[model samples]
Target: MTISFSELDFLKPELGAEFTGDGVHFAVFSAHAEQVDLCLFSPDGKEETARMPLPKREGDIWSGYVAGLRPGTVYGYRAHGPYDPSAGHRFNPNKLLLDPYAKQVMGELAWDDALYGYRIGAAEEDMSFDERDSAPFMVKGVVQDPNFDWDGDLAIRRPWTDTIIYEAHVRGMTMLHPDVPENLRGTFLGMCSDPIIDHLTKLGITAVEVLPIQYFPDDRYLLEKGLRNYWGYQTLGFFAPQPRFMAGDRITEFKTMVKRFHAAGIEVIMDVVYNHTAEGSERGPTLSFRGLDNLSYYRLSPDDKRHSYDTTGTGNTLNVAHPMVLRMVLDSLRYWVGVMHVDGFRFDLASTLGRTRHVEFDRDGGFFDAIRQDPVLAGVKLIAEPWDVGDGGYQVGGFPHPFREWNDKYRDDVRRYWKGDEGMIACVSQRLTGSAVQFNHSDRGATTSINLLSAHDGFTLADTVSYDGKHNEANGEDNQDGHSANHSHNMGWEGPTDDDGINTARARRRRNMMATLLLSQGVPMILGGDELANSQGGNNNAYCQDNEIGWTDWSGRDDPFVDFCGRMIAFRKQHGCLRPERFLNGDNEGPREIAWFGEDGAPMDEEAWGQAGRRMVVLYLAKVGTNGDTGKILDQLLIVFNAGGECELRLPAVNGAQAWTRVLDTGAQAPFEPVAAEETVKVPGECVLAFQSAS
Candidate 1:
């Protein structure tokens, strides 16, 4: 039975008179409430409260239709029901609440006790409900038309093998950039500007994965501590983009950013947090999901109905195991890809999505299966953070096929090797070659691993070699919040000093780690400010600090560290053999690609790998050939890595190759130039050298 607009008794025409009869319908889902009122606010601060008793109630789903509501209409909801805490019902008629299906949130939430359904300082806490009206404090959701003309904009769909990802914060990336305009900085439009585009294109990265852009709120705990939620992990509204990031009219601004990125031939991937929401544990405030349906939306422990299952450690985890809950996640993903034209998604703490009602990880979980079979979402890129704080939540190499995972092992192993750790040669070798042991057996290839040394969650590359432990006094957590096992080794000092030997050692270690990341076989991801030696003063986790500690400082433009990053990325693009989708079989099936060698100019032996204090230089050579197998051989590229002190030995001679030329030397003086093939290039003490073999 088709329902017509005129026949719907709750129809009201005010803000959107243009599309009243145009087939657009409004439906909202609220389970516990007896009646839901739709309140529309005018531009002059006058409100027209429309009382619409839900026409139908199907197992707590109270939905109704309202015609003539279009984009830019400010509206909210007032759910009326019993106020009980022990039974998990916290509904209050006086408190105004945001609609769960809000497409866009207009402004920031002003802090006030009226926003909470329960009394702020009541003796019984959330048990006693307050009758104070919260209409002035809550943010209202705007009804968006969801109509945009995307003219020939399609996902670039770059394969993981050939992709290079650059992890950046949307606001911090361009906040201090000298090239961007003053007004555009710290907004979505600023990131898509020509200056930012030119920088990313010049670096040769294929994709730009921004941090959480979904509408989130600054937590009360953070606000009381004089801090803000800068990382955006504390999501409040899943369907709406954060109003702070919006430059103009909410919906069109985000669409414009996507179009601009598509025009630049760059793919946009968002870091999404579906594992939990901003609403904390049972004692937390009554927000959208919790206030709507606590039993259906969150995964509550059977033993204790008063508390929620805290797998995310963010107070509550979304019950993706539920059928309707799973639909909400899938619907949100498709909306971004279909309507917003986003290229990919990187799930934050994705392991929670695979948990079942029994609290066990399932490989064939409903969330994973649904996305794999989705027609529109199947073709796009899917990435996973691969872990959570739940019981049995570490599933790094356990993700299903057609999905890439952020390899934490890669980050740890690379750090240990560069820090001069003994017995790490064998482990480092496996990681540098894409960890075939972890991914090769399955249908996934080398590209299944997103390799990196440092990301936004941990220590920056500069601080990794300069501090041994986390120094988070500024975070107000008494330095007890972040990770304790950093596996970091400062050269000699605990913090910054003027010691030349220690400073030089730190610089060499940073270069070694960066070189390994670029030369690795899997897809590489570089943190935003690591190029200029950015540091957070040894703070491993800066989730709440939005000040200079998190922003990028471009003042170090003249430093050699930044120059090295620029050259390293350029060198990787020039050599195609380094980033292969599959492991090197050593049979020359594809090309005379990668050749492993020891310091003695011979094949690497198992004993050599086990020996302590032994560093090996891997020599990689890629020969170019035509599709017809009848073209001139292209120049052979050679990379030499020296992780130890200065040493002299006979260099390995290429088979059927006469000459080699030096292309890049990490230890060279100013005006470094490529040398002749016959010229013997001295291996630096702790540096990498790139050469070309041409006959």
Candidate 2:
């Protein structure tokens, strides 16, 4: 039943007659506002002068029923209240605003003083009120008619232990693909095409964790600098999909992409940033949240109402401790899961969601508890970045159960060990084994540690070994924007070098790092372009780079590094013993499944762990079964590493193993050959090697 705009009456409504149809039911939650007006635009978008005041005001919510206004109708709201910033009220009846519950927003906002509730250059800036009608400068929300046929597509809830996550950007992944059509290059359809699916399937990753797809404003600052927000962290609308990613049809294209991915036996996880909105601060524009109800939606300083509590460092953090704000987040998550068919979400700056009015991390915060007890959300994956810029914000391994955390310790230790930082044997061993000391408590299994070496926010694997410091002059920030503590060592020279010795060392280090990440006992997450040795020319923070530096360049298809990535991923999937659900201990059910050995083929000594200049060796031995069936082993893998200048590794002999075959040699050149079983191979220095023992 589609109602036409003429049949709808906003001045009065028949309460008993249930409006059981897809029409526009305008509603705005403004606690301080006295009245609200609904303004509708025409079809051709020339004359928009129709206005109707809301008939009912229940508590702070102003709602009215519009009968004939169906989907695709553009509309904005104007709330009437006192325009005083010192009293925490920045409302102006003439200024138009976007609804916080809008499912779809049309048009981009033009930057101008008319969009702000106060004059820009006034002496009291934001404190001086302006009487400008912002209907022309604001984006109008569309009343969408939601319907889609899933065709038996379901979320593949792969177990946490066997899951391999691949972090990628939706646009950057397929923007350069030759197979995707030129018209659909950066759209949702492009990512769901054969080229992208084939690459993900071949890599053996169970999940593709994409960056932010929510509607975000292309910042005015980025435009001024001739750059883009390539990462999509600055969100404008929490519920609506970004219009730029939609092609042909708008919302249906996003649903089709999710359905296609699910049909391919892969799960989709979204990287969501609910910590803050695009409305920067007091001086920022009057976007949705700030104009709706600034005091209710944002966390203001307790003593000083003029300032906001900015734990997210991206301006005002959302006040999730508020009941209504918590409901908004939970509603959005459930809508995405049940309606949009998303598998999970990775929260950006998740610590901010768990903070209270006191600015302390509460385990049972309103936002966290609401999602935990929900029947629909409890079944899906929940990952946390686990930190903010506030005091005591670094809660690396301090999250509760049912929440996996990004293990920064694993990343730091892996870089230090492979870069030849001595006296790191103990820390390296702990990281390789899933950092059991950090996650073993509170019933969180080994999979709780989402191990990753390089992510979208930092340097790629190739850049980490090539440059010691970030050269971000290309960002136009005078090389002062990115991180200062890189934890990188440039073998001998910085950046690219003509010296063969230095280039060879850099290549070996990339392979070694990839091998370690896949072989580690945890849920491994691979950065999208790291496999192809993608470099940003030593730019650690390329959040604003949308060119070749950010996109996946397929021109290097014939490069040896591309083949190395495929081989390393295959090795991890073929070996079930590498990714264990439980931590390994010397005294488990029977004999030790994992045994660490020193250079002498014996248990490592404490002295070797403390030596500042010594680069030690480790041997991983897995016993097949429990007590009696231990002798009937399936296969044993030996991983040897020589980080020092050169060393001769004495291979450990297994009791029932028939022969040892060399499967991987990181130091070899193009078209590497595998040695036959029982062959005594020579291992090179500063390289990693892997062998399979079969009976």
User: What residue pairs are clashing in model 2?
Assistant: 3-68, 4-68, 5-68
| Backbone collisions counted per model | 1, 3
Among these predicted structures, which one has the highest lDDT? 2
Q: Mind giving the per-residue lDDT tens digits that candidate 2 earns over 1-695?
A: 33224434453231111233644567667787778777777753334657778777776667777665567777777777777666667777777777776777777777778877778899978788778777777777766777678888888888887788989988888888889888888888988988888888876778889899988877778878998888999887777888778776478788888998888888999999989888877777786777778878888777765567799988778888877777778778887898799999999999888895458887677777778889999889889998999888888878877889998889888899988887777888888888999999877787889999899988877789989999888789999998887678788998878999998888888888888888888888899888777778899988998888788776654267767877777778778668777777755554356777766656667777777876766667563664676645544677776677666655666444446777777887741366764434456787777777754
Model 2, which residues run further than 4 Å from truth? 1-22, 44-49, 497-499, 621-635, 653-659, 669-681
TM-score of each: 0.91, 0.93
Report lDDT (Cα) of residue 114, candidate 2: 83
Off by over 4 Å in 1: 1-6, 9-24, 31-33, 44-48, 57-61, 81-88, 149-151, 489-505, 558-560, 587-594, 619-638, 653-659, 670-672, 677-681
Candidate with top TM-score is 2
